[model samples]
Target: MPKRYSPQVRAEAVRLALEHVEAHGSAYAAARAIGPMVGVHYETLWMWTKQALSERAWRAQRGQSGVATPPAG
Candidate 1:
């Protein structure tokens, strides 16, 4: 079976992915470059970053409108 990572590990991976994306200007590129170094698959890291960014966008939108954002899957 594949190893399971803790929430903190996942969060850190997402954070790293985000920083990589910001620096590289592409999530795919960021994942490809940083994933292996971080011990995560590129596609997995991409998905985590995508979800984190979406959640942040949702929260920002809700904050602006004073409404709650729906939870992401």
Candidate 2:
């Protein structure tokens, strides 16, 4: 079976990946660095990072524009 991570773990991983984005030059690179420490695969971490950022942007824009956004999936 695949390993399962809790919501808090996922959120922390995403936050860590974002903090390192500038230093690492991209989400993928940040994930590569943070993944081992957080016990996640680089690719998985990168995807989570991307999703978090996308949702944040979507919400920010929705607040400003007062428009409904479509589901990311």
List TM-scores for all candidates, in order. Answer: 0.82, 0.88
Global lDDT scores for all candidate models: 0.84, 0.90
Worst 10-residue stretch by lDDT in candidate 2? 64-73
CA deviation > 4 Å runs, candidate 2 = none
Q: After superposition, how far is residue 67 of candidate 2 from its true place, in Å?
A: 0.4
User: lDDT by residue for model 1 over 1-73, one digit each (tens)?
Assistant: 7777788878888888888887888888888888898888888888888888888889999999989968668
Location of the lowest summed lDDT over 10 successive residues in candidate 1: 1-10
The regions of model 1 sitting more than 4 angstroms off are: 1-3, 71-73
What TM-score quantifies how close candidate 2 is to the native fold? Answer: 0.88
